[model samples]
Target: MRKQLINPPQIYDGSPFGMSQAVIDRASATVYISGQVDWDANRQVSCHNVAGQLKKALANLTTVLEASGSSEESLLSLRVYVRGELGEFIGDIAPILAQYLGESRPSLTGIGVSSLAYPEILVEIEATAALK
Candidate 1:
């Protein structure tokens, strides 16, 4: 699979936040990952705050990606679910995401929801990727 991250000159660059305006993927198979929360190996909520939970959730997502024979660079898109006000937490989210993904800018979406799978899970992230 081949993946291209696109940040058109006409639009604002999203690379700083680990996101692209769009993605171009040429692949024979696509991987649809389930929503990953901040669950540890013991199936316990790893964090309580939004930022902390998001960090752990991203780690879990990465594990899933690797297990699927794909890396973060192959990620096509991400749908982030937040339990509370996004504006309050975007300050914490952007930097962590950028550091985690580096130059692999994939299309990202953040949605504010009432709750998630667990009451303690402040954030959940689901991803789509091209198989390596």
Candidate 2:
């Protein structure tokens, strides 16, 4: 199955932020990944800062996506929850997410929350992907 991105000239580009305005997936199964934080198997938030935590969270999310027979290209959307403003890190994080997501740019929503599940956790990312 293929995921189709819909973005006409009337709308602005969203790829820089690792998102698209509209995404249509044709996979038979849909995978809902829980909010993935920087916590390891030991249930510890080893990453102390947003930059570090964001990297780990993305990696964790990627593992789940792959395990589900889905890839970043099969992703439908990502809801990002950050402890603080997401603007400052967009320049840094967007590129990394783009690299991870490759050519397929899925829809995304970013929200700034007061805190996450743990004190040391600065960001949590949840994803929805399509699987065959």
Candidate 3:
């Protein structure tokens, strides 16, 4: 798995992500996942809050990763989109992420967006995972 930093130097230096000092180095065989929502396999909208949706979304991401023979530990980056304030949303999902990812949290980016794919949905997470 590749090592990704929370805040790469290039991101800070006015450069694109392709060139980043925070990226100590990188490995290959990355798996890209699209934005995951709160829907279940039955196509039912599960949770109303960010935490519940996040859990389901993470589970969805895990399914995608596993299908490609990868695990959560192989995550190189996680980009999270929230419909509101960071503190309000993250307060619910952070602990779940801590438990799911264990020690390696992976590089994270959280943004406050106007809305999500669904009106009730508050959080969506997209990931890039590298295989060892």
Top TM-score hit: 1
lDDT (tens digit, per residue) of candidate 1 on 5-92: 5443433334554765334344656666667777664558857888898888887777667656678998889899999888888988
Tens-digit lDDT string for candidate 3 (51-75)? 8878887877676666555678988
What is the clash tally of candidate 2? 0
lDDT of each: 0.75, 0.71, 0.68
lDDT of 1: 0.75
Extract clashing residue pairs from model 1.
Answer: none
Q: What is the Cα-based lDDT of residue 9 in candidate 2? A: 36
Q: For candidate 2, write residues 1-132 as lDDT tens digits.
A: 476554333233446657543444555466766677786655577667777888888877766665566777888888888888888678767777777778788998888888876677888888888774
Error of 2 at 25 (Å): 14
Superposing every Cα of model 3 onto the true structure, what RMSD results? 10.2
Higher-lDDT candidate among 1 and 2?
A: 1
Top model by lDDT, which number?
1
Better-scoring candidate (TM-score), 1 or 3: 1
Candidate 1 wrong stretches, greater than 4 Å: 1-27
Report lDDT (Cα) of residue 49, candidate 1.
Answer: 88
